[model samples]
Target: MTDTAHALGASRTLWELIDRRATLTPDRPVLIQDDRRLTFGELRDGCERVAAGLYGMGVRPGTVVAWQLPTRIETVLLTGALARIGAVQSPVIPFYRDREVGFAVRESKAEFLAVPGEWRGFDHTAMAGRLGARGVFEAYDTLPADDPSVLPPPPAEGTSVRWIYWTSGTTSDPKGVLHTDRSLIAGGSCLAHALRLTPEDVGSIAFPFAHIGGADYLVMLLLYGFPAVLFEKFALPDALETYRKHGVTTAGGSTAFYSMFLAEQRRRPGEPVVPTLRLLAGGGAAKPPELYHAVVREMGVQLTHGYGMTEVPMITMGSPDDTAENLATTEGRPPEGMEIRIVDGEVRLRGEAVCQGYLDPDQTAAVFDTDGFLITGDLGHLTPSGHLVLTGRLKDVIIRKGENISAKEIEDLLHEHPGVGDVAVIGLPDADRGERVCAVIEQPPAAPPLTLAAVTAYLRGTGLATHKLPEQLERVEALPRNETLRKVLKYKLRERFGAGAGADGG
Candidate 1:
């Protein structure tokens, strides 16, 4: 842990951290939107007032409040107010429709549902009502108002479960991942220490604030005393100006973000995409080693990827000062307290940063092993230097002719192909072979179409085994991705291509 993190040990809750930071750096900016800024002092005062207003509305400690708002300054304040009052907050992603929203609200048993009225041409208030949400109200430009004197004492403990974050639920209903102030603080501390950031560094939150990463990033800022630019809607060329305008020193959301920046830099060969950008760091999906080399070679910026999930916001993170090979090939190292146990090639975690469990008792019981380690479901191994190299998920293994083949091994090799903009390898059921390898690709615009023979040739040239070569190839304009983090939904691919057992491809 960094000295700052150790010194702030007295801050047991998120509200306490906010108060301490505000006291230490009252005038330092913590949040920045288009034309608005909120300093630490302003954040504390504003949130307290909002908390008082919520208190007036009978939102006391432990009250369940569900909010689905955009990434705006007000949303931050609302979340902070909930923290101040010790409310159990269930943050739903803004893009979720009735099915997801209804599931979250009902599962969390939220007493109040906060919406943005009609945002992005959708009536969230109406949807909340349709779901029979209690205390449905709009919290866009305005929030509740009352004097701060009515507010009770802030939360004193940090270990109590106070957050419920939903997963992407690609194949089934989203599961609510339970979290506490301490777990979030631990996750943030790992990120902050690994990145070696300072107060002088400016960051950017291009993803949704409702995502688990939002809290992870916010905790870093609170610890290091820095500010981040908020993007209501993040697009490549459009958001570039804001990044340049703010002199964003650190920016990245995931592997896709690195690809976008690299693409933008390619547009202007001689110029940097963001002159102030020095490092790109994020974690949610897998990172191709080629992508790391490409970002560093072309963008002239250090790219440090990490391993994390909704259950544990941060598990391992690459350090800025680590060896180049480690940064490129491994997911850095875990913090001092995080225990990584490799059981039968699967990575399991036991640490303070890890989430308490799922909202469903059955899920909680099933996910944790007897040793109290959360079964991560990811397959990986720890290097000699303690870095993690993920192979793939257990479910991602393809069984072919009594042999197990790793899909990620093929996907990583395919990522190097110039014709393949992005690719996903899956095993289609085959009566004789058990399963046949299939590759779904998204070709780059204006690039020559990719052929199955050409792909097989490239793999063969890479010295890949002939049996692992894709037997079929499917091309699409774009792959289906989850809303948050933009992770490709491979299950959808299986659904789309699993039926044809024996199909010829070019």
Candidate 2:
């Protein structure tokens, strides 16, 4: 472990780590957005003042305060202030609406709710009122401000649960995952150590700050005393200016991010996309090996992908020194202390980085096995070199003719097709076959239109089994993705085409 990781691992709370880093590098930049920059010292002082302001509003220790704000410096300050006050914070993604927001507010029993008011032409404050959210207030440009002397000392215990992160409710309502200061620190340390980042390295956070990754990334900055550029609204070309202006050395959100960067690099063939960019790293969705190769070969940057989820933010992360083949094929190796047990082909996790459990006791009880490992629904086996190779989700298996096939296996193969910009393989109900394989593709603008027969023939030439070949093909302009991390909403694909409505194959 790096010295920074060792010191941060010993921290009792997130606030403690922040304060320590601030003392070490009081003038070093910690957060940057366009022309604005917040140094480590400034962050600590700002958070204290915000904590005092919140305290004056009756936000004492253990208060359930929820905020649905964008990725901004003020949002980070507010979150830090909550940590200082020992408030149980529940951060909701800014894009979430009535169903998700209402459920989170009610489930967390939030005493106070913060919104960004009329951000992006939507009246979040009005919506919070409609949901009957208690203590609704705006926290966009301005936050509570007061004397820091009035606030109590920061929480000393890191084991107590103080964070409630909601999972992406694709199949059902989002589950409230419980996290503590120590757990989040552990997750961040794993990422920081595995990436082998130094204090001189500058980072970027393009994803939602409300996401669990926000905390995970922040913890790394605190540990290494490095700065990261924050993008309130992230899109290619427009956001590229900020990355270049800040000379971001390492940046990536997910496989979609890699694709977007690669697309931009293709537009300007000879020149580098972000000249300062030396590494691209992220993990949330399955990364196609072809994407990795394209980023390395075409974009001229080392791409290190990892495996993580709401349950455990950093399970495995690829290092820069790793072999190109292992880095592309595997999700990297688990760090020390993380126990990976393959139970019946399912990945089970037990470690300090793992979450305490869900807010729902019964749900938590059902997910953990008798041995106390969180029963991850993912299916994978560890490589001989200790790397974790994820096949697909247990629920993502497509059973056709009494044989199980991995959707990721087909999707990865399809991603190699030059005509395919993006692809998702789903199972649709069929009368004759229990389930038929459907490959929904998003073709590149320059590529010629594809047909069902053409896609199957390509797969067959690649040695894919006849039964595993996609029996149906549906072309779309773009695949449906969630706001954060841009993971393809496979459930949405299944819902749209499950009834054989869009099948174009024999």
Candidate 3:
């Protein structure tokens, strides 16, 4: 972090950080969308007005406010305004339907809700009404505004929990992860310093603003005094124009995002997808080594992957200065304040960047160790150079006839095939073996269909063990992915193929 950023990092709360940045870089652009550009001064002044508007609506300090809005300029203002008033925010992914949204709202005890009205033909207000949500209001194009005189002073401390971010909850109802302003600042600072960004660097937020990475990215911009283009509805080729127009120096949401850009580049061979884009960086899901090599070779951009989650938005990030071998094979080193521990081959973390805990006290107690380290159920070990190499999650282990198999180990090998665009290896229940291995594939359109024999043959050629070989194969038009980060939903695949979605091939 720069000297100015380090000084800004000492702010006691998110609102204080915003105010400090606004004071220093008042006229500098902070957010850009279509034709709308918000400067730091405008952001500070605008949010204070909105803060008064929210206070006028009976929102007080510590009031739980739930918002399900897309990635837009208005969403940031609402989040900032809430911070200015010291409200506890519960941001739900916009793609979530009634079930997950209702669960988050009730669990957070949200006293109010902010929606986008009828965004994308879905009436969020009506859904909130159906869910019996209180204090529902629309905040799309226009926001409530009032004089700043009506609002209370901004938050005085950063240690108190003020954010409630949800897990993806692809398998079960999501868990509400608790975070404070200081924790978020640390995560964002880790990202900003690791990437070595400057004020001249234009970034892009192509993912949903409801996710924890949203806050992390926002903090990066605030710290480095840079601007980022917002994509409310991001898609390939269509969104490429905006990226080029803004001269985005850095772009990416996750490994899925890198694949999307690569696919686009292949569509128009010998042409740059986004000429100004030089670095593709993100971390939410595991990045395949083949995917990294392909992206660096095809897109002609540096790809820096990382290891992060809702609990700790920025654990370790690959730096642009690191070697290509390290960038391709391992998640980069953690910063000074962040600590990574490998306990019995499982990665455990204890740091300020880590979340305070979960909403439920029992869940919190179960996740943290006796020494205050957050027990990440992921299996991995630190490299000699201090990089993180994740093997798989504890739940991702496939036990067949009392023998343990790592799904990631098999997935990594299969990802090397020329025909395989993406693959998800899952374990399914079987009458014979305790659990059978299944490989679900997403292939290119022009590529020939891969048979189970061909896949097993390829795996065998790679020297995969017989016990770890896949027993079944399923082909899909595309892999099921969540809205944010585009992480492949392995549980959904297990649910689909576990019910005999495809014939067994052994």
> Candidate 1 versus the native: TM-score?
0.80
Where is the poorest 10-residue window by lDDT in model 2?
Answer: 396-405
lDDT of 2 by residue, 136-244 (tens): 8899989999999898879989999999998732233567999999999999989998998888999999988998889999999998889999999988888888888
* Clashing residue pairs in candidate 2 (N, C-alpha, C atoms within 3 angstroms): none
Q: Candidate 3's C-alpha lDDT?
A: 0.87
Q: Which ten residues in a row have the lowest lDDT in candidate 1?
A: 395-404
Question: What would the TM-score be for candidate 2 when compared with the true structure?
Answer: 0.81
Q: Give the distance in Å from residue 365's predicted Cα in candidate 1 to where it truly belongs.
A: 0.6
The order of the candidates by lDDT, greatest first, is: 2, 3, 1
Q: Which digits, one per residue and each the tens of the lDDT, describe model 1 over residues 1-506? A: 45775676447999999899899899999999998999999999999999998888889899999999999989999999999999999998887777668989999999999999998887889888888999888888899978999888899899999999987322235678999999998998889989999899999998889888889988898999999999999888999999999889999877667877888998998799999999999876566678888889999999999988878889999998999899988988998899999999999999999999999999899889999999977899999999999876755666453234668778888999999999988877653344678999999899998778889999878656565789888988999999999988988998998888334462
lDDT of 2 at 141: 86
Q: How far is candidate 3 from the true structure (C-alpha RMSD, Å)?
A: 11.1
Candidate 3: stretches off by over 4 Å: 168-171, 396-506
